[model samples]
Target: MHIALVTETYPPEVNGVAMTNQRLVRGLLAKGHRITLIKPRHQEAPPAEHASLQVHEVFGIPIPNYAGLKLGLPRPGELERLFEADKPDIVHVATEGPLGFSSLRSARKLRIPVSSTFHTNFQDYCADYGAAFAARWMMAYLRWFHNQCALTTVPDPSLIQRLEKDGVQRLQMLGRGADTVLFSPDKRDPELRRSWGATAHSPVALYVGRVAAEKDIPLTLEAWAAARKHCPELKMVVVGDGPVRKKLERQWPEVHFAGMRYDEDLARHYASADIFIFASTSETFGNVVIEAMASGLAVITYDYAAGKQFIQSESNGHLVSLADRQSFIQCTESVIQEQSKMPPIRAAARATAINYPWSATIDRFNHLLQKAAKTEQITPQIDIVSNSEQSTL
Candidate 1:
């Protein structure tokens, strides 16, 4: 099948959505599916060449407060022209940004099947960005945007329930997978640990994601600090960059800020750590959690999405009640203090993570896209009111 994949983020951008989209593209390509990629041109360097993949980089504006990310601009007419030139079997919208919206509009206008995936909880992020009042508006927009699609794919069942409550229709669960081979216990580097001022005896706590307020990074620091009191040699390393990196660096001078590490480097960082602390409460699904688990680290994350799905609390990895900062800290400290339990927990984590491979994810994704393509095109719900020969969505 030929699929037109539309997204705002892609490779070279160190984020879950970007990485996941890249993985999906690779998976689909491996399955012999032709892909037409549409994304923001955040950099001048073109994406890597692929035999079955076509690239379309569009004009984009740097997203405010999100360093290294871009908000794709709308190009409906341009997209329509491209689609008409080489029509795809289905349009898979991976984001809800302007570009994705335009892709949906153009595809629907051409009576093509279009599906979407809800990767991020954008409405939930409104409160974190001091726009609590806008959450309702954001959610309403999301409901309308997703309902227009033949089906809206979600990462977990919890998100499906939430979206359904919000009036979004035809929601399907599409779980994510981690590269167990890329992120494995064998990748653990003692030299890397030594560089972070951590010895074999010392416990290292690692956080690998955007250093932003929405991520609840402050809570990770708090947990690390509390754990440090119990284990003086405890080293905390944060391995990502974001808008608040500078401020966080100033506030937590003790942390080994490794900035951004990708591929094997990221895996090494995860393996070298003894425990993984992801305090983010705003994730639709935390990809880092599975990556850390695959790296054989005793993870401590909130009990939701990936955490709830993969973790068996006190067995494979630790799961704190959602949004309970106090429990999160206590869980971190407890996991560190019970040093003997780490090996078993890490082993169990790896065991669970390996079961979710990209092959299975890709199969499910292909099935969903096939289903979408075969289904009758969904009528777009957005009312088009024309004023002065202009149609507003």
Candidate 2:
């Protein structure tokens, strides 16, 4: 099947959504599906394209206060023209940005079936950014945008129930996968641990994600501080860049900040660590949790998203009650104190990650696209004339 994938983020962006989309596109191509990827052109370098994958780059602008990331401007007419020229069998909107809205409008205008994916919790993000009042407006807009599609795919059953309760229509639950080969216990580097001032015995706690307010970085820091009281030699390593990095760096000079490691390097960082710490509660799906688990690290996360979906608490990994800061810190201390039992726990975590392969996720996504293509098209209610109107948030 020929598919048109519309997204604001893509490869080289160093985000979960971009990486997942790239993997899905490659998987679909391997399955003999032609995909036309519509995304914002990178400022530095363009990504390599495949024979079956056609990449259409559009104008984009850097997101405010977020370096190394760009938001694509909507191009409904251009998208319409491109679709008219080639005419894909189905359209998959991977983001709810302007580009996604434009793609939905274009597909609707041409009477083509379209489906969407709810990857980010933008409403929750608004609360983090101190714009909590805008969450209702944003949710209303999101409902309007996604309701135009034949189906809206979510990551887990919890999210599906919440979205359905909030008036989101036609919700489908789909799980994500991790690259086990790339992220494995075998990739652990002793030399890398030495570089971070960590010995074979000293505990090294790792955090791999955006160091932003939404991630609840303060809670992670508090937990780390409390854990260090019991395990004095414990080293904390943060592996990601975000708007809050500079401020956090100044605040916690003892913690090692390894800004933005990708692919093999990222896996190495994850494997070298003894424990994985994630305190974020605003995730539709936390990809880093699975990646860290695949790398054989004893994960400590809240009981939600990937943690709730995959972790079996004391058996595989440790999970604290959602939003309970005291429980999170206590759990960390308990896990650190029982360091001797971590080997089996890490092995169990890796075994669990091995069960979730990327091929399964790709097959599920492809099946959904096929189903959407076979379904009837829904006409769009909003009128879109040019990029100017659609580009505005």
Candidate 3:
């Protein structure tokens, strides 16, 4: 099947969206499906063209106050033209941006079946931008936009109920997976542990993700501080970089900042850590939490969305009620103080992550596509206006 994926962000961005979408697209290719990736062009990108898979580019403006990121504006004519030439069997939008909305409208214009993925909490993002009242408007717009698609996929099931209550239509439960091979305890290096000031049996607490405002990173710092109060021998390590790096480094001078990592280095960081602390309540799915667990690190996150669905409290990891700042800190302390009894927790954490394989997730997605195509009434092919100069699809 020919699938066109539209998103504002793609590879080299080093965020959840880029990493997850890369896995999905690569999985789709391995499953013998054709994918046309449509995204905003980065500065000094490979090219506006592609061979194995088609790549349609659009002018991107820097996201306000987010210098490292670029947001796609409407490229309606360009998309319409591309669709006219290389008609996809289905259109999948991975982000809700100007490019996404343009694809939705163009797909409707051409009478094609389109699908969407709920990858971000756009409404919450509005509040993060100091426009709290705009959240309702954003939510309403999301309801309208997603309702136009034949299927809308969300990574977390609990979000389905919430979206349905808000008048969303035809939601699909699509979960993501972790790379266990790259995230296992075997990757833990004795030398790396020593670098973090960790002894053979000392606890090494770690956080591996973007350090941003919405991540509630201050709470994580507090939890670590609480944990340290109980276990003075504990070593703290942070393996990712973001806007908050300078402030975080200054705030905790003793903690190790490994900075942004990828490939084997990232794996080593995950494996070396004894426990993972994630305080974010804004994620649709906690990719790092699963990655940490797959690496055999006990996880501590909120009891909602990703964590609540996978964690069974004392069984695998700790899942405190959302925004329970004090409880979260106390839980961290408990784990560190009682660190000797962590074998069962670590084992359970690994076992829980075993089922989350990219192959399985992609297989289910393929099944959903087959089902949708079989059940959906076929629409007549309409040529999308394919003028290279025009920027709408």
Tell me the tens digit of each residue's lDDT in model 2 across 19-109. Answer: 9889999999999999999999886656556888888888888998778777888554999999899899999999988888888888888
**Candidate 3 weakest lDDT stretch, 10 residues:** 384-393
RMSD of each: 3.1, 3.3, 5.5
Alpha-carbon local distance difference test for all models: 0.90, 0.89, 0.82
What overall lDDT, based on C-alpha atoms, would model 2 receive against the true structure?
A: 0.89
lDDT of 1 by residue, 287-339 (tens): 99999999999999999999999999999999999998888999998987889
Give candidate 2's TM-score. 0.96
Query: Model 3: per-residue lDDT, tens digit, 1-393?
Result: 888889888766768887887787877787788888988888655542334577777888987545456878755487888877888888888888888888877776766678888888888877766798778777877876777778888999889998999778889999888788888888989999998889998889998888777787788888998899888988888877777788988988988999878878899999988999999889988799889889999899999887987888888999999989999999999998887778899989988888888788888788776565444533333333224312321
TM-score of 3: 0.91
* 252: Cα error in model 2, Å: 0.4
Residue 50 in candidate 3 has what lDDT?
A: 31
Model 1 clashes, total count: 0
Q: Please give the range of 10 consecutive residues that has the lowest summed lDDT in model 2.
A: 384-393
Residue 205 deviation, candidate 1, in Å?
Answer: 0.3
